[model samples]
Target: MRIQLTFVLLFVAAVLQAQDIKISTKDNDLKLAALPYYSYGKGLGITSADSLFQLNIRFRMQNRIGFIKNEGEDDAYDGQIRRLRLRFDGYVGNPHFLYVLQLSFAPGDVGEIHDGENINIIRDAAVIYRPNRNWSFTFGQTKLPGNRQRVNSSGALQLTDRSINNAKFNIDRDFGLQAYYLNEKKDQFSYNLKAAVTTGEGRNWTKSPDNGVALTGKIELFPLGSFTKDGSNFEGDLAREKTPKLLFSGAYHQNNNARRTQGQLGDDLYQQKTLRSFFADAMFKYNGWAAMATYMSRASHNPVAVDPLDPTLTNYAYVGHGMDYQLSYTFPTNYEIIGRFSTQKANKDIKAFTPDTNEYTLGVTKYLWEHAFKLQAEFTYDRLSFNDGSTKNNWYVRFQIEIGI
Candidate 1:
C-alpha cells in the first residue's frame, strides 16, 4: 500500500514537471492543459505554426502486485512496476513521413541482460514513410509483425500480461525494415498485409552478429467489418461498437541461424539453429462484448543443440505449441468482467526439459476514463503437468493500477 501511494504521488510530481518543462525559446511547455483539466490520451500534442512538423508526447506507468500459493510449497508474493515508458510520436518534413521514439524506465521493462549488458532503455526508434493511404514502409528498430498479441501495445491489454504462447514463440522486436498495405471499404470489407526483415538478434544486442536474419509476414482480414476507433488494437470493446466487428489474422516467421534460445530472445545458444514460427488468431467485438482466440506453434529441424565432446553442455529452443482464448463483457457503467483459458504443450524436442501447463484466469477492470485511468484485479489457477507424470498446482492473485496520458 505504501508503494502504491508513492507511485501516485510521483505521477503527480511528473505532471507538475511536465507543465513547466519548456520545449522552445517561446517558453512553451509540454503540458496540453493544467492537470485536473486535460484531454484523454491525446498527451501533449504540439504542432508547428506552419504545419510542417508535429510532435505528440505521452507517458504511462503500470504498478502491480501479486500473491502466489504453490502446492506443498511456501506461499510467495511478487510486486513491482511492471512498465513505465515515455513516447514521442509525430511527423517530420511532412505528414507523409513520420517517426516515433520510446524509452523504458522500469527495471522489469528492460528485460533480462543479453549480449552482456543491462542498459536496454530504448524501446522503439523507428521512422515510417506512408506514400499513400494504402502503403507504408518502416525502418530502424521496432516490433516485428509476428503475433497479434505481441503487436498490440502493452498499455491496452485486457489481462495482466500476454499469454504463455507469446512468451515462448513470439518473434518480438528487432532492428528491421517493414512494408505494409491496407485496404478497407467503410463498414464492409478490409484487409491488411505486413512483412518485415530483421537481424536475427533481438533488440539491444550491440555485439556483432553472425549474418543471420529473421523474416516475418502477417495478414489480417475483416469478414464482418472493421471495429470503430481501431478497436482491434485494444483488448476489449471499450468503444462498444453498435454493429458487429470481426477480424482474423495469420502470421509466419522464420529465423535463420538463430543464436538465442527463444529466437530473437533468451540466453545465447551454444550452436545456432533455424527456427520457424506460425500464428493464427481471431478477434470479435459487438455491443460491449469481446472475444479473442489465438494459436501459436514453432518447428525446428533440431531444436536441441548438443556439444558432441561435452555431453553436459546442451541448449535448445522452446519448440512447442500453445493456445489462448479470452472472453469479456463490459457494462455501460464502465466496469468489465473477463475470463481466459490458456494452455501450452511441448514437442518431442524439448518435452523433457519443459512442462506442459494449463491456466485459468478471471479478472475485473474499472475504467474511469477509458483505459487512460483504470484499476484491474485478477485471479489465476495454474496447473503444470510434467513429462515424468508429476503435476503441480498453484494459485495467483494480482491487482494493478494504470495511469497514462
Candidate 2:
C-alpha cells in the first residue's frame, strides 16, 4: 500500500512540473515527443527537444509457470510474476550527465522488513558522468562490477533465469562510486577497466552501522574486437557475427569487516569479518553460436562464531567455490537452443551445514523481437550432497514470456 502511494505521489509531481514548465525558442529548439512501445515490456517515453533534459518511463514484467519435484515429494505447480519493474532514466542539460531510477513492485522483491518498512521499490538510483569517450564515473546505488552473468540485466537473459552459481557468488548491488576506462583499437582489440568503492550493505539500507566498505576491480580484453551493439552484455549471438569475437575478463572484490550474513545481502551478522571474492570468465561468438564459461570463489576470514547465549552454539558464514558453462545457438528464424552446467561446493573445514550441488539445464527461446519480446522454456536437474553423506535430487520445468517496449 505504501509503495502504491509513493508511486502516485511521484507521478503527480512529474505531471505538475510538466504543466508549469514550458520551453520557448525562435528556431523551434524546444520539442515534445512520446514513444509507446511493446515487445518484451510495455511502456511509454517522453523526450525533450535537442535530446537534452529528457525523461523516459518504462514498465516491465515477467510471468512464469513451473513445476518442481523433489526426490520423494509430489510435484508442485507454481505461477508467479517473477519481476515487475518501473524505470525512469534520462539526462539533464548535457548528455554526458545521465541518471537512472528504477523500482521493483513484485511481491518477491520485498524482502524482510527493516526500520518498519519493506523496501520493494528503489532498485537503482545512480548518476553517470562521461567526460569523454575513454573515461566515465558513476555514483549512487547500482550493481557492483562482479561476474559477467550478474551484470547482465535480468530482462535480457536468454534463459528463464540465471544459473545457481550466479545466485551463490555474484556481488549483487550496493551504494558506491565507480570509475571506468576503455581503450579500443578499431577492429583489432579493446581493453576495459573498472573500479568501485561502496558500502558493503545491500540495496535500500538506510544506514551502514558496520562502517565497512567493499572494493572491486575488473578488467576485460576483447581480442577480436568488441561485440556489436553492446553484445558482450547480452547473451546469444543476436548479431550473428560473420567473424569470431571473443572477450576475456577477470575481477576481484573484497568486503572489509562485513556484517551481512551473505556478504552484501541477507540478515546482519552478529560479528564483523572480512569477505573476499574472485571471478574469471570468457565469452566467444561466431556466426550464430555463442558460448561462455565462468569460475567464482568466496572466502571469509572468520567463518564460524560462538553463540553468546549458549557455550556450544555456533554460526558459520557461507564460503564456497563454483563454476558455470553455457552455450547457445540462434537460428535464422530467431529461435535459440541453450544448454548449461554448473557445480559448487562449500569449504570442508566449516562445522556448519554446507551442501555440494551440481545442476544441468536445457532451454529453448523464440524471439519475436530480439530480447524485447521472447518466449522461453527450460528444464533443470539438480543433485545435492550434504555433509552427513546424504544425497538428494530434484528437477523442474518452467516456461516464461517477456514483453518490453
Candidate 3:
C-alpha cells in the first residue's frame, strides 16, 4: 500500500509542480514557459523559448465496459479501468537527444505478485539520439521492432481493443537498443528500416534471465509516397489523403533460447527453445478509405519435452500463425466505421493443446477530438476449434472511452 501511495503522490506532485513553474525571460535568450493543455488531459508542458529543450507531462486513461457470452455458458458482464498512464517526454540539452518515460498506475496493470504489491509501474523509459534526419539510435526499454499493430500505441487503436492474434503473438516490449534509418525523396519517404537487439524477457526484468537475446529487423517501402501524416502508424484515414498512398512492410524476429513461457511476457519456461517469427503487412489509403492486412507466423525449433518423472507434464513455446485484415472509412463528421477479420491456427504439432480460432469484429468510433478524446464500441464474434473436431463459439460487445492529454 505504501509503495502504491508513493507512486500516486509522486505523480500528483509532478503535475502540481509543472503547473506552478513560472515563465520568465532572462535577456530574451534564456526563456522558460509552461504551456497547459487540455486536449487529451489537463497537464502542463514546459519548453524553452528557443525550442532547444522541452518537457511535456501528459496523462491518459481508458475506461471500458463489456459483456461476453461463451458457448453453452452464462453471459458475463464487467467494467474496469482499461488503462491509466502517466507520460513524460522531452529533450534536455538538444532536440537531437530525446527521452520518454511512461508509467501505468492501474491495479490491472500489475498482476498478482508473490513478493509484495505489484508496483511495477514503469512502461517505457528510453532515450533516443538523432544525429541526422535519416538515422537515429534508441537505448533503454520500449516496444520491440515487431508487428505493426504491436508497435502502435494502444490509445490510438481504432477498435475497442487489439485483435486476439496480437495478444497471442505480439512481441510486446523489451529492454533494447534500436537503430532506425530512412531514405526520402522530395519530402516523401521511399524506404525505412528499423533493427533492434534486446533481452528476450519482457519489461521490469533488471537482467537477462537466459544466455540468449532477441534480434528483430523491419523494413518498409512506400511505393505511392509515404502515408499522409504518418497514416501507416495510425488506424483510419484521418488524414484523408488527397492522393493514393501505399506501404509495404516486412519483419523477421528470432529469440535464441528464450526462457519465458510466452517468449517474452509470461512465466519462465522450464526448458528453453529457439523461437522464430516472420511478418508481412501492407497498407493503402485513398481519400477517407483505408485498408490494412498483416500475416505473422511463429515457430519453435524443438517441441516441448515431457517431464522425465511425469508423463503428463510438458513445457513448450506456442507455435502458430495468424492474419488480420482491417478496413475503415472516416466520414466528414469525424465518425469512423471499421471492420476486421482475424484468424490464427496452431501448428499441427501443437494442435492437441492449442486451439485454432477466428474472430470477426465491427466497430464505430466517434473522434470528439481526434484520438485524444474518442468513443468507440465494437462487437466481436469468436469461433474456436479443437483437435477433436469439436468447436465452440463465443461473442462479446465492448464500449470504451479514451482520454489523453
Candidate 4:
C-alpha cells in the first residue's frame, strides 16, 4: 500500500508540471525524446520532464551466467542476479536541491544465509549548489573527484573489474561533503580540483566519530577542439588554427587513514595501524584509438612484521599497477569494431595480499538493425601463481545479445 501511494503521488506531481513542460509533440509524438526512468533489472519507466527542476525515475533487472574450466576440475556453471535497482532522482524548491533514493537488490552472502534479500542505498543523492558555471558544492553520496576512470560508472569501464590500485587509492563511493571547481580554456585545455572529507570507508558503513580526508585533482588536454573560454563555452571560431588532433588527461590522489588494519599469515584478526596511499593515472585518445595506465601504492607507519621465532607474524606493504588499451573504428552508419587489452599486477608479500594472478581478454562486437540490437563475443584467460609454488590456468568464451529501444 505504501509503495502504491508513492507511485500515485509521483504521477500527480508529473501531471502538475505538464502545464509548464515543453514537449516536442510535432517532432514525433510516437518517438520518445529520452527514457526518463531506467533500470538494469526487469522494468522501466518514463518522466514528463528531463531538464533541471525536473523529475526522473529508473529501474532495472539483470541476470548473469558464468562458467569455468580447469585442468583437473570439471566445468563450473553458476547463474545469479546481476542487479535489481529502483531509483528516484529529481530536484525541489528555490535552492534547487537534488535528491535520490535508490534501492538495490543483489545476491550476496555477506550477512545473510544464502543469497538472501538485500536492499540498500546506492550512488550520489545530493543537492548541487552550482552558483556559477565553473564551481559547485555537493553534499551527499558522491565519488571523490579522483581519476576520470574512477569517477565513471563501472558499467562504462573497459575492464571486467576495477584495478587493484584504484581500489587501494580511493574508496569507491562515499558519504561525504565536498567542494569542486572546474574550468575549460579556449586553448583546448581544462582542469579540476576537488577535496572531500569522508568516512574513509565505502558507502556500506555509517560515519565513524573520527573519519579521514581525501584530496584529488585532474588536468585535461583537449588539443583537438576548444571546449570553453574563461567562463563561457568555447565557440568554434578558431577552427582554422592548427591544433593537436588528440586528447590527454592525467590525475593524482592521496588519502590518509588514521585507523587502518590488516591481517597476517596466521592471523586471528586484522591489526590496526596508520595507513596512507597515493595514486596516479593518465589517458590518451586519438581519432580512433585510446590508451590508459594507472599506478597506486599504500604504506603503513607501523608495518606489521611476522614473529621470526613463531613463524606466525606477517607484515608487508601493498602496491599495484594497471594498464589498458582500446582501439575502435566507427563507420558513418555507426557500425564499428573494437579491441581491448588490460593487465594488473600486485606485489607478492603475503598469500592474500600477494600478486599471484592475472587476466587477459579479447572481444569483438557488431551492431545490426540500426543499432537497436547488438551481438558480441569475448574470450578470457586467467593465470594463477600460487604461493606454494604451483600454477593454474583457466579460460572461457562468452556470447551475448543486447537490444535497446
Give the per-residue lDDT digits (tens) of candidate 3, residues 1-405.
353355346434543544534332221110000010122332567888887788878888999999999999999997999899998877777655677788998777766666632356888888876544555567888877677777777877899788887877888788877766656442365988777778877788864466788888888888877665456667788889898888888999888888765677765566777889888888888889989899988888665756667878886677889999999999999999999999999888788987899999999999998888899999999999999999999999999999887
lDDT of 2: 0.77
Worst 10-residue lDDT window, candidate 4: 27-36
Badly placed stretches (over 4 Å) of model 2 are: 1-44, 50-52, 112-118, 184-186, 311-313
Instruction: Give the number of colliding residue pairs in candidate 3.
Output: 4
**How does model 1 fare in lDDT?**
0.80
- Give the Cα RMSD of candidate 1: 11.3
Better model by TM-score: candidate 1 vs candidate 3: 1
Model 4 CA deviation exceeding 4 Å by range: 1-53, 60-62, 70-72, 108-120, 158-170, 185-187, 225-247, 258-269, 302-318, 331-336, 351-353, 367-376, 387-389, 400-405
Better of 1 and 2 by lDDT: 1
lDDT for 334 in candidate 1 is 88
Residue 135 shift from truth in candidate 4, angstroms: 1.1
Give the per-residue lDDT digits (tens) of candidate 2, residues 1-405.
353355346435544544534433221110001010112332465667676676767777889999999997988998998888888766688655667788898777765556754575888888876554555567898888788888777877889999988877888888877666667554788988877788888787775366677888889899988777557778899889888999899999988887775677765666677889999999999889999999999898667766666858666667889999999999999999999999988887562477899999999999898887789999999999888888999999999998766
- The global Cα lDDT (0 to 1) of model 3 is 0.76
Q: Give the TM-score of candidate 3.
A: 0.86
Candidate number with greatest TM-score:
1
Could you tally the backbone clashes for each prediction? Answer: 0, 7, 4, 14
